[model samples]
Each structure stands twice: as structure tokens, then as C-alpha cells.
Target chain A: MLMRCIRAEMRKLRGAGIWWVFALLPVISAAYGTFNFMQNREILTNGWYSLFTQHTLFYALFFFSPMVGVYAAYLWRMEHMGGGMNMLMTMPVYPFCFFAAKGAAVLAVTLLTQGWVFALYMLCGRTLCGLTGWPPLQIALYMLRGLLGALPVVALQLLLSMVIRSFAVPVLIALVGGVVGMALVAQDAGIWWPYALVLLGMNANRAQDQLSGGLGVYVLVCLGFTALLCLLAQALLTRRDVRA
Target chain B: MRAAMLAERIKAARRHDLLLAALTGLLTALCAAVRPEEDWQRAVGYSALTVNLSLMNAVVMPLAMAALASRLWDMETRGSGCRLLFTLQSWESLFGAKALRGLVQNVVICLAEGAVFLLAGRMWGYTQALEIPRVLWLMLCTFVVNAMRFFALLALSVRSGTQVLPLAVGLACSLLSVFTAFMPERLTLLTPWAYDVPLSAMRMHYDRETRITAYEPLAFPAGLLAAAVVCGVLGYVLARRAVRDQEV
Candidate 1:
């Protein structure tokens, strides 16, 4: 059922509105990189990496994370919009299964979107800087660190989308939360700062020295918080929003 | 005219006050007061004030524009213009009225807060580049930027029934940052305000030789004004469609 729901979501995105967002992504990415290319053409490769490194969290905080959440919330909303919620609620499927399916669908879309971003970066690198080579091993490590960092953001967004009724509320909250997170990040006592989780996924290549010295408890702390957030999300869903 | 009806439609859709009040209160009370001083002796009283201003402007309120946008029409009663508003016509007029209303409301609240901060600073005998008026200027700058922002967003909501949360914010911050980043030496000779005041007065520059870049009011206001025009046009188009689109 979850897989089925994921397929449906893919099909639904085939609509004009959702595809416009997808189309807008590459254009925006290219535009932003072009802006960078114009300013610091010499550091194009490192610049792209740094741009992704710093901006990924910014994206998660303000845009992508909340987008995924809103996308999920709207899955429920689509039903309501179509006057199908009553039928869905009375269907043979468990209520939890319905949300679970939406969760899977959102995750699939997130990874697909991220994959597009990765491709966009590669393509932009080749076109803007006229380079045809892959970045160093540290680049992958940096991306991994970023993904790890974004884990909690993903979880929190999921929670917001799951419970919030208004289609716009969760994303709004996430945007507000993102700002608050960035301000308090430097003062963070530890990596448990969920907003700072995106920092966990940061490419430590710039500070290669830090990675070799050991992730210095930050990595574990991020993972710990990610786990904590996931548990909280699961519990929250079961209790109110996503029932079995 | 029918334009008044459409404006009322949009007005009913959104809830601007929630965003305004939350941002004002949050920035004043929570955002501005974070970890005030690393060490009191090292901290200039005004420097603390700058941190307060920076948080208040950049982090707290600017990003809420989308939420304000989302609410703009969501709060509308049946998504129609106020039957009573006699002054509106065309989608642009409706958008203008809403945008102007939002700007005035934000500015008024901000000014009221400025008075309190001004009195406090005078009591502390704090007189420097970071003055109450400068802070007020930053707030106004934020207000102008946000007015354009909220306007564009509400306009988008009118067109599409929903606004892209992240996209709206990225654009707003990048727009806002242009003003906040450089100060002192360079001429952002971009606007009257940037020219009238010290561009870097409210800015914090950590890594440059001059430390802060001078403000460029011209470029920012131009960008913001252009955004206002484009968004206003698009929002009006959306509202027109929404009015015509059969309810689902």
C-alpha cells in the first residue's frame, strides 16, 4: 500500500503545478550558481561544494524540509480537496497505513529531488566552469555529513506535516524555526541542536583536520537527536495524526 | 466596483495580524535578547543593541512573509473584497491597499517599540553610530523589504491558492542581505536613506578590513520595488482567476 501510495504521488506530481516546482529547481540552482560563477569564477569547483555545504542547511531550514512536510500534509489535503477523505477513512486500509504511504511517497520524492540537485550541481559545474572532472573523495563525505545533518530537519518537518491541519501552517512554522535555529546554533551546547543537524552533514573537507581528529562527539550527538526526533514523530503520529 | 469585491476576497483569505504580532513580539522579546554579552566589560552597550537589532530584522520577521502571504487569503470571508471598500478597483489596487495597510501596521508597531528602546538608550547615556533612529531605519528598511515580500507572497497565494514557502524566503533574504552585508567605505549610493544615513550604522562586519560595507539603499529598494510590481501583477492575475475558478 505504501508503495502504491508512492506511485500515486509520483503520478500526482505529474500535474502542472507540482512539475512547475520541479522545473523551477534546476533553473534556480543554475541561476544561483551563475551568480556564484560571476563573482568567484576561479573557485568554481570548491565554490560549488561550499555553496552546497552552506546553503543545504539554509534550504532545509527555509525551503526543502518544509516543502517535503507541506507536500505530505497536502497528501491528506488532496483527499479533502477531492471530497475523498470520508471514503478513505472508511476504506479497508488502516489509517496509519495511509499516512505511512504518504511518508514513503514524500521520502521518495525528497531523494529524487536531491538526486536532481546533485545532477544539477554536476551539470552546472560542467557548463559554468567548463570542467569535466569529479570533485575529490571529500566531496562525498561532505554530502554525507550534510544528509546526516538534515535528518532531524526531515523528521521534524514530517512531524509538522503529519499533525498540522492547515496546509500552510507547518511550513510556516518550519521557516520561523529555521531562523531561530541558525541564531542559536553557534551557542549550541552540543550537536543536539536539531537545526544544527544539517551542519553535521557539512563537508568537513574544508576543515579536513576536524574529521580526521574524530567527529568530536558532534556526529553521535546529531544521530542521537535524529533518533530522538524520529521516535517522537512516530509517537505523535500514532497518538493523533497517523493511526494504524 | 468589482475590484473592491476581489480585494475583499483576498483580505478574507489571509490573517496578516497573526504574522505581524508574532513577529513583533518574538523579535522584541526573544530574538533581541539572546546571550546579551560574552563579557560586559568587552561589550559596548550599543553592540548588544546591534545584536538585538540584527536578530530582530534578519532572523525573526523577514522569513514570516510567506506565512503572512498564506494567511492573506485564507482569512478572507468567502475570498471576496469587502463590499464596503469604495476605493479599490483592479487587482493592483487591491494588492496596493493590502500592501499599504501591512506596511503601515508594521511600521507603526515598530515605531512604538522604537520609542521604548530610545528612552532606554538615552537613560544609559548611549549615543553613538548605533542610535535609536538608526535602529528605526533598519526596521523601516526591514519593513519596506517585508512589505514587498508579503505583498509578493500574498499575490502569489492569490494566483495559485498556495505559496512556495522556501522559495519565497530565499528570495527575500538574498534581497535583504544585499543591504545588510556592506557598509562604511563603499557607496551603496542606491537610495535616499542609504545616502542620508550611515549605511553601516546597523550592520555588523566581522571579516573585512573596513569591517562593514556601506549601505546601498538604491539597489535594494529597486529590487524590492521591482519585486512589488511583478508580484502585484501576478497576484492580481491569480485573484482574478480564483474569483472565476469554480470552487472545488
Candidate 2:
């Protein structure tokens, strides 16, 4: 039943004009990073992982999380409009199931977008910088880890969109999270901050830097925080009376 | 028209829009203050502080203008307000009032930023005395640049209907503005987003090898003012057309 609901939610998003919000950030990030890489070609070494890492640091630091917020907000936009929430609540389905299906669909889109960005980064690096080594396994590992680290951002943004009703607030929160995350990346405690997790995870995979001992703890924190937020959202949705 | 302008003023004040702008100015000031105490005495000079603030402003102020414009415009378009707003007043008057309010708010915020620079300079042991004319000129340039951006956003808001599109575009431009400092001079003149680049009150001459630095006034206030007038008229025309289409 939940699978059907999720499929139905996905169908609603077809031709919905929200895809650009998902695609723009990654494309811009990769293009800008590629431009910078080429401009500094003399200074930068042409290794595959090295080139890929330089481009993606800005992505992980700034674009990835906020783009997730945009996706979540786009998904919730319809339900927030024109008595739609009240109408949905009047139906016989469980509120948790209804929200879970939407959440599932958004999560899928988020992961797909991340994968596309990863592939695009590799393609750009190979073409522009004469990257040679396949490094397929390393690339996959970084994508998987960064996607894992982004789970909490997805949950937090979903919950914020679910509750806030205002379109810009959730997105601004996510953008501010990226700014705060960037600031925290300079301090020792950045590894513990949930907003900074994806950044730290990406940094751990860089070819130049030795993987810090705290990478394991960072992964655990991301998973734990995701679980907590998901549970909190579920509890809140079950209790609230839906109103226009 | 007077009633419409008054209504717009009340709505703006009620929404705490000015407060948000003031807070942004303060935040920009705080960002400028991130220097060591030793640098604070010597290196944290007027032109240097202005350059730092201008760089931060390039990243932030465009989006802030977009947000403010969208909030003002979107409030009238969300749900029942859309239908009611059109019926109550001519769209021209409404648009005019809102645009005026936005322009006034931006000018005030620009001045507030200038005031912040003066305070930051004096408080941080800036060696030079307050150079009010140069600081005011920078403020004027910022105001003109933001006016152009605000007008562009107003046009976008009228056409897009939804709040997200204008915002997303504005933010993308804001992100691009971060790199404008490094852009070549000819490119800077062509890219509307790079207007802030020319407004950098600090003229930096860095010796790539020797690494010596010097500061002078770097501003093209007249050029920015001319651009503002042109973009402002274009925005007005576009918004007027959008309203006409809505009426049809």
C-alpha cells in the first residue's frame, strides 16, 4: 500500500516544473568548478580524484543541502495550497503513510540527483583535465558516503516544509545551514555538527588529505540524527490536526 | 495613489522588512570585523574594511533585495489576496507604491551599511579619520546596484507568480557575484551582477611576487547610477505589461 502511495506521489510530480530546482545547483556547481580547475590548470595536478575533489568541495559545502531543501519544499508546495492539506486529511489514509510516501519519493529524487552530479563531475574532469584513471570504486564510495551524510538534511528539510507552510523559510533555513556549516568546517567540532556532515564526509575522501579517525563517528552521527528527526516528524504528523 | 502608498508602507512596517535589512547590515559589519587585534590596529584600516564589507555585500545584498521584493509582491498574490488586491486598486498604482517602498527601503539599508562601516572603522582603530564622502559614494553605488536588482526581481515576480522562481534566479546570480571580484574589468562592466565589483571602495594594488599592497578609492558611481535608471525603467515597463496580461 505504501509502495502504491509512493508511486502515486511520484506520478503527481510528473511535468511539475520543479525539476530545474533539482538540476540547476549541481550543473552550476560542476560547471563553475570545472572553469576554476581549467583556469588554475598550471597550479593544480591532473589526477582524477584530485580534480573531482576540488570541484565537489564547493558542492558539498554549499549547494548539496540547500538543493535538497528546494526539492522538499517543491514536493510540499501543492499540499500547502488552496485547502489541499485539509482535503488530504479528510481521506481515509493514515497521515504518516501519506507523508512517508512523499518523503520516499523526495529521497529517491535526491539520491538520483546526487548520482547524476557525481557522474557529471567525473565526465567534466576526464574531458577537461585529461583525467586517466577510472577510479570507479573511489568515486562510488564518495557518492555513497556523501548521500548517506545528506540524509539528515533531507529529513530536516522535509519536516520543516511539512510544518512551516511558508515556501521560503525552509529553503532559507537550509541555505543558512550551509553557511553555518562552512563556518563550522574551520573549527574542531565541525565533525559533530549535522549540517557539516556531508562536507566532512567529502573531505575524508579527498586524495590529498589522510582520512581522519573521526570519519566513523561522523557516519554514526548522521545516521543517528536522521533516525531521530524522522521519528520526531512522524510523531508530530500523527498528532497535528490538518488545517488550511 | 496616496492611499496605496500608505497601505504599502504599513504592510512593509508590519512585516518587519526594515528590521531584516538592518540586521543584514549588522551581520555584514560583523563579517567585516573578523580580524586579529594586531591587524585591527594596522591592517583593519578604512579601505580594507570597505573592501571586505563590499565582498560580503556582493554575496548577500542581491538575494536580500530579491527576498524583500518577493515578500512584498507575493503577499498580494498568495491565495485570496490575489483576487482581492486586483479589485481594490489599479495594478499600476499598486505596483508603483510597492516599487517606491522597495526603493526607499534599499536606500535606507544602504545608508545603514555606510553607518556600520564608519562605526566599525572607528571602533577597530582604523588609522584614518572618517572619510564621509567616499563612504557615502560607496553607499550610493550599492543603492543603485540594488535598485537595478530589485527592479529586475519585481519584473520576475510579476511574470512568475510563484515565489520560488525569482528567488532561485536571484540566488544563482548572487552566487555568481562572489566570483565577480576576480573577473576581468571588461567582463565586470558587462555583467549586471558584477556592479558591486566596481563599487569596492578599496583600490587594491597587489604585487604578485613582492606582495606589497596599496589602497585607493575604487568606484564608478555615475556608471552605476546610469545603469540603475535604465534597468528601473525596463523593470517598470515589464511589470506594467505583466499586470496588463493579468487583467486580460
Candidate 3:
């Protein structure tokens, strides 16, 4: 039943304008990446890795975090409309199931964005920068790690979106969170800083130097944080009276 | 007119935009404070303040404007308020009131920011004294720039009936504006978001022979004024049309 609910939620998004965000975000990030890459070409001697690092930083800090926040807010928008929440509660489905399905859809979108971002990163490395040596293993690993890292952000956004009826508040917090995360990333507190996880995961400059234990710690932190957020969200959803 | 403005103030108070505006100001101040001392602790205090403030304005104000505009519009459109507002006053009057609210919010934010910048400068031990003319010039420029964005975004918000899109566009612009520091002044003038880029160039430059860091206001470019005027006119026209076309 839960699977059916999740699939239905995903199916409902077909032909919706929500997909434009996913399509446009990568292109926008790529354009910025290419711009920065070309601008720094004279100074950047580390080749593909340096360019990729800058690209991933821009993607993680600005584009990806806000996208998660907006995606979560968009998921709840339908229900938050006047009398919509009450109408939804009248349905036979449990609130937990409804929220779980929505959360799953958001996660799917996050992974989709991560996959496209990874593809664009590699493409930029190959064609634009003319780095022929394919770092396939590292690229795949970073992609998976980035996706895992983003899970906590996705869950937190979902939790916020579900709790706060105001659409902008969740997004505002997320944007502020992302901006703050950039500052936090330098401090090397990735275990506690979910916002910095995406940057830490896909950062070629830092990751290339310390890939083994560093990444494992990030993955563990991200997973633990994601689990805590998901559980908290579930508890909150179940306890909430449908008054929206 | 007084009644309309008063009512708008009450509505704005309820919406908590003033709080958001102040919060944004404090956040911008905090973000500016996070900068390494060397960046802002230049030989000439005026240059340092201008540079630091310009960077903060570029990064923070655009998003704040979008969010505040969207939130105000959303509050009006949430339920029957959208339909009811038109009945309470003429579309022009309603538009005026809302525009006034935005202006009030902007003024509050601007004042808060100015206070913080002064406090930050003093605390950071800026070597040069506080230069009023340059400080006032940047403040006025930022005010106009923010007002222009508010008008444009309010129009977009009213027409679209959603805050997220306009906010997203603003966020994207804010991201792009970070690179405006690198672009030529002429190109920066093309985008309203980079109104500060020219001023940001007025940093304490090192002289080769004298071995001194000279502090000066980069000549106020005529092109930025033109850009501000263009944005103002465009925003007004769009806003007029939006308010006129608003059904609910």
C-alpha cells in the first residue's frame, strides 16, 4: 500500500511543471561552472579536479540546497491551500503514509538532481576543459556520496515544509542554511553540519587528498542525520491535528 | 491617503515583514562580519566600509527584497483577502498602500543596516574616520536599488500569485551577482543586482611607487543611475498592469 502510495505520488508529478526545475537547475549550474572554469583557466593548473571542485561548490551551496527546499515546499503546496489539508485528512490513508510518500518523492527528485549534476560535472571535465582521462570510479563514488549527503537536507526540508504552512519560511531557512554551510564547511565539522555534506562529498580538492576514512565518516553522519530527521518528521506528522 | 497608509502598516505588522526586514539586515551584518579582517580593515576606512557593504548588499538584499515582496503578496492572496482587498479600496489605492509598505520595510532595513555598518566599522578599528558623503551615497544607492527590485518583484508576485518563483529568480540573480565583482563596470550596470559592483571597485588600491593604499570613491558611474531609472519605470509599469489585471 505504501509502495502504491509513493508510486502514485510520483506519477502525479508527470507532465507537471516541477520537472522544469530539475532540468533547468543543472543547466544553470553548468553555465556558471563553465563561466568560472574559463575565468580561472589561467590560474587553475590542477586541471579537471580544480574545475570540478569549483563547479560542485557552486552547485552544492546555491542551486542544490534551495532546490531541495523548494521541492519540499512544492510537495506540500497542494495540501496547504485553503481547506485542502482538511480534505486530504478525510481520505482513508493515514497521515504517516501520506507524508512518507511525499518524502519518498522528494528524495527521488534529490537523487535525480544529483545524477544530472554528476553527469554535467563529468561532461564539463571532458568536453569543456578537455581533460581526456575519465575519473569514472571517483565520479561514481562522489555521485553516490553526494546523493547520500543530500538526504538529510531533503528530510529536513520536508519536515519544515510539512510543519510550516508558509511556503517561503522553509525555503528562506534552507537558503540561509546553505549560505551558513559554506562558512561551516571550512571549519571541518561535517559530522554535525548536514548543510555542508554535499560540498564535502563532491569537493574534489578536499576529497582527492582524503577519500577513504573521510568519506566513510561523512556517509555515516549523513545516514544517521537522515534517519533522525525522518523519524522526527514521522512522529510530528502522526501527532499533528489536521488543521491546515 | 492617511487611512490607507495606516491600514497598510497594520497589515504589514501582522505579516511580520518588518521583522523579516530587520532580521535580514542583522543577517547581512553578521555575514559581513564573518569576512576576514584584512578585507575590511583597509588603510582608508571609507573604502573598506564601501567594499564590505557592497558585497553584503549584493549577496543579501536581493533575496530579502524578493522574500518580503512575495510574503506580503502571499498574505494578501491567501484566502478571501485577495478578493476582499479590491473591494475595500481602488486598485490604485491598494497598490499605493502595498508599495508604501514595501518602502517602509526597505527604510527599516536600510536604517538597521547603516547602524550595524557603523558599529561594525568602529568595532573593527577602521583607521580612517567615518566619511559621511561616501557613506550616504552608498546608502542612497542601495535604497534605490532595493526599491527598484521590490517594485519589479511585487509586480511579478501579484501576477504569478506565487512567491517561490520570484524568490527563485532573485536567488539565481544573487548567485550570479557574486561574479559581478569580476565583470567590468559597464557590464555590471546592465543588471540591477550589480549596482554595487562599481562601488566595490573603490577599494584601497596599492600605489607602486608611493607604497600607500589610496582611499577614494570610484566615480559614481552615470550608467548605474540610468539602470536604476530603467528598473524603476519598468517596475511601475508592470506593477500598474498587475494591479489592474488582478481579479482576486
Q: Who wins the TM-score comparison?
A: 3
lDDT of 1 by residue, B1-248 (tens): 35554555454454445445445544453444334333331234455554455444443344455554565555432233333332334444554555555555556545644554555445555433444455655555545555555555555565555544433443344333433333333533332222212322444434455553232222223444454345445644554454334232
TM-score per prediction, in order, is 0.67, 0.86, 0.87
Displacement of residue B248 (Cα, Å) in model 3 is 6.6
Sort by lDDT, best first: 3, 2, 1
TM-scores of chain B, in order: 0.52, 0.88, 0.85
Candidate 3 lDDT, B73-164, residue by residue in tens = 77676774768877878888878888888888888887777777677666766666776766667777778788888888888888877666
Tens-digit lDDT track of model 3 for A1-244? 6898799778867775567667776776776777778877776667766666766766776557777888888888778878777876777877778778987999888888877877887788888878778765766777777788888988888888887777776777776676667666656665477777877777643636444667667777888998898889778867767663
Report the C-alpha displacement of residue A60, candidate 2, in angstroms. Answer: 3.0
Q: Compared to the true structure, candidate 3 yields what TM-score?
A: 0.87
lDDT of each: 0.50, 0.72, 0.73
Candidate 1 local distance difference test against the native:
0.50
Q: State residue A108's C-alpha deviation in candidate 1, in Å.
A: 1.9
Better of 1 and 3 by TM-score: 3
DockQ measured for candidate 2: 0.31
Off by over 4 Å in 3: A204-212, B2-14, B34-49, B79-81, B122-128, B204-217
